[model samples]
Target: MEINDLTAAESRVWRAFHKGEPVAFGEGEAENPATGSDWGPERTVRASVLRALLLSTPQVDGEIPRLRLSGARVTGQLNLMYAVVDHPLHLRYCHFEESPDFYGSRLRQLNLRSSVLPSVSLASTRIDGPLRMTDCRVRGPVKLAGSQIAGALFMDGADITTSDPSVPVIQLHQSVLSDGFAAPGLRVRGEIRLDGATVGGSVNLEGAELSNPGGNALRAQSLEVRADIRARRLRAEGGVDLRGARIAGRLDLMRSRLSNPGGMALRASSCVIGELWLFRSEPLEGTLHLRRSRIDVLSFEPEVAPGEVLFNNLTYTALTPHEPADRRLPLLERDGDGYVPYAYEQLAAAYRHVGDEGAARRVQLAKQRRHRATLPWLGRVWGHLQDTTVGYGFRPLRAAVWLLSLLAAGSIVYALHHPRPLKAAEAPEFNPVFYTLDLLLPVISFGQEGAFAPTGGYQFLSYALILTGWILATTVIAGVSRSVTRQ
Candidate 1:
């Protein structure tokens, strides 16, 4: 490009690039009225001239060749597909007539802070330094899929909206960032996909509002983050998918409002996270599916108990709030998958880990009750008998109480009417207490049950006592065996 062909603004930009200076047409404020739409050729720079300067211009010996233009109106599409730009590009507070295409480009650094563009395509692009688009507003998608950034990606306070509902507003799938992705206070009207992405540092998404109704607001399946994911107070309308995501640090969703009606609000199944902080101010409006996921610590203290949850096979070492088993049992009861023994067993193990043996037993007891509900009618009836008689082997004192009550009743009945002796020569004494003990104790014989025989009503009474003793003995043995097997 010849210097004589440059427009007034383009000439200033060209000179500034060679001299390593930023061309500022208006106040640095993003909403400065001087940089409004009424600007003429004096503030306009053609994209072709800017591209030429970045690609063909020779670098000065003493200065860096950078395109640092601010508060300017770019007229054409700055297509730099597959271009390798060594200079840092900074286009702050600028307005673009067409979206810039940087697909497969390798750049030293890229900053579009507070700029307004129709869209941006940086798919498969590689950045040596940070990619900063803080406070920028894009009307269409910002494609960054398969991109590799050596530095952090910042989009703080940016508003990225899209008319197309099927596509994501910001695509970071398969992207790798060394310093992580920060997007606090971001407002996105479509999905932000980070599937298969790897972030070296933490992801900070505080106070972001993502609205893609009836679809995924944030789809981050299989994302591997070396650090934490701080998403406190995030308001997502559609849902969030963190399935198979592996985070080294905490995934904090404290005070976040996630709603998708009947659908799952957060699907984090098969994930391996260090800690999950879900202490919300309000209850989750939809189901939270964490099936087959493993976490170190689960902080689940919601203001209201969640209604639907799918936590089958979820394994967590610890639980927050240190609540009793009763308080935590409600959460297991709300499992949408229904009668998941693994979930209950995991909770019991968690309680045991904290040295809460009583709570652990309570959890196991609840597990039995939950499992009983799914059994057949006869099985349930038998379960009820075991529950009432022995508290399903959890409360051993109940068995003792039943034994003592039956023993007392038998002793009183036999004391009122003594049975005839089988042989007068062999009979010792008719002690009702000893006789009742001999009848109840199935394993041992006191030599009195065989020595004596009952007649008429006494015979009927003896038969009833024998039957009752056998039933109680059989139930006790069954309960003991079940408890032993579980241990």
Candidate 2:
């Protein structure tokens, strides 16, 4: 790469690299300088020149060695695969003829801010400094899988689209980032995968649009983040899977619009999050599955409820803006999957933890009602009887009322029609109250029941009193047993 053989634009870049000065050919930082297709020699720089300058160029006295070129059309393949460059490369507002390949390469820093790239391949590459690609427009997939970024990865205001919908537009799966992954205002046409990735700091993706209809919009299963995953105002057209993920801080998806019609809008099964904030968001168009997930605090007061919600085995220690059981019971009832007893138990436990015993009891009563719906016809009949009489053991006062009412009815009927004596010599006085009491008490016996005999309709009345007494005893015993076990 002789100076004489270099083009005018390449010569300037070569000269500026040794002096550690940036050569800018663009009009302004906001607008692209390579907008015209007919870029003359002055605005064109061969990729070979850049490769030579990075690998073999010597630094000037009192100056560092770095390639900083702006607003230039890079020709030829800038293949730096397996190359180790110990200096920073800043090529802002540049247009590339081919995708820049940095696979398995190691660099001090790489900044391609506001550039137009066909694609980018940084798989397995190592960057000691931050890899900034803010406001860049990428036409194809950007691969960063298996890469180890020592600093933050900035992708704010970036617009990335891929021709193939099956592949992810931007993939950082299994990659390790020392700092945060900030991608505010990013727009992608395909999935953005961070599956199995470990971020040392928070992942900020505010105002991002991820559209991969009928597929995964953002797949980060098994991801481990030290801080929060803030995706406020995110618009996703497909399911966002966070299954088995571990977030040390809150998963804030406030005001997000998630839609996947027939599939799940958000699937966070088996996830362990410190706080899950899903409040004030648009009504999810699909199911929200939180099966087997654990959260320390949950704020689930959405503007409009999700179409369906699955909360099987979900455990949360606390709920924000705590409402009574009546208000929150609808969320549990939204579980489209078959009856889940554990979901009700968890809600009741949460209410009890907050020192709301009344709310907790209401939740338990609702659980019984829901369980009754799944029983057989005979079992359901028994369930209805228990519920009506004693509230399935939750309302003990109701049992007292039923018992008093039955005693009064039995006494009135016997007083109106008295029973005859079996033998006049041994018969006691015809006291209606004592006679009814003898028939009502199952284990207790009075001399009146042994001496007197009810005839005709009076006999049927005696039989009815005996049967009613036994039923009341049995139901009371069952209700008391249930309450004791629950306590």
Candidate 3:
């Protein structure tokens, strides 16, 4: 169709395309040119055929085909605004050196699959049906702001590169992205995802969402998304900030790597997250978890809670071997006044692993104090004994108590068996020195030995005292042994 030979309506649509205005279709505006009839099965079939032919053609610069409604090479800038096409809008193998504007237009369908456009602007464009693009290369910025996509938007296996740091490869701001938005394995040299884009439906990016995961070569600010963002492998050189984002369902980022100096923060203060899986991801240089994230309560097992913060199996290199004690960062610190019982337990375990028994015991004591109401008296005693320093201080007192107990027991036994040196009968003539020696001998031996005597009554009394003293000594030793073993 020659530009001047076109009908008035066709020329108007062409002018709108050049002006980059969104195409608005009225009734009967998309009638078939061959039969002069509205769009139907026959028109749809013809459009599909023409679209395939257009895709097959080898596109070159300044090559416009002369066939009516022909598909030819589209170089420089191709504007297709508000123009109604009875068939699919196919732009295959076309390279736009400058920006290609396709604002507001009514078409049966739009398929830019396998096309290369440096900068494509489709602002406020309305598609009655689906928009599919696969393996297309977008070298510059691709803006789809305020566009309404009734059907799905598929951009699978597309390479989008942008040199500007401020502009994203694909921008979808305030647009009604419905049904679904899928871009699996879509590589964006710059930021690939949207900033405040709202997907009225689901988003599937499985095995995609990677931005230089190997080393700290590439650095990004964040992957911001207001909608429920689901991906299997989301990697970034910087942190992943999902603050104030509401995800109605689960947010899965399994096997992802978030490398940032301050670590990552998946903060969802009031957002409803069905389930969040941050398993097997690389550690951030700082804290791995966040402060206020309302994760699913039921999804977590007893070993792990919803609000519980975990930083397990992470290896950190010390900035300096002999760094100042004050400057050294702790593996974990109790900041908030929440459930500190679990925090203390974890701290104790870490200390124990590092062979700091003293610190471990101190942590245990702090835990006891926090939960003393739940523990038994014996548990309290055990806590005290676990402290080596405190236990040492009480050893001497314990020994003294043991010795006193033994002396008391011995006194009782001797009192119960003593026989009055009665009736030394007939006040026998006694040597004062010999009597004194006999008395001193029994006292010095602590009544543990019998006196030498020929009389039967004297020998019996002496043997009883020796037997009682031996029994008392054994009882004392047994008591001491039991006390030490119990501790």
RMSD for all candidates, in order, please. Answer: 1.9, 2.6, 16.7
Each candidate: what lDDT?
Answer: 0.88, 0.88, 0.47
Candidate 3 residue pairs in backbone clash? 22-103, 22-104, 23-82, 23-104, 23-105
- The TM-score of candidate 1 is 0.95
lDDT score at residue 81, model 3, on the 0-100 scale: 64
Clashes of 1: 0
Model 3 TM: 0.48
Instruction: Give the C-alpha miss distance for residue 189 in model 3, angstroms.
Output: 1.7
The digit string of per-residue lDDT tens for model 3 on 61-110 reads 45443113211223235555655444445444333344666777655567
TM-score of every candidate: 0.95, 0.92, 0.48
Residue 203 error, candidate 3, Å? 1.8
TM-score of 2: 0.92
Give the per-residue Cα lDDT of candidate 1 at 80: 99
Model 3 residue 228 CA deviation (Å) reads 6.5
Q: Global lDDT for candidate 1?
A: 0.88
Q: Candidate 3 at residue 484, lDDT?
A: 56
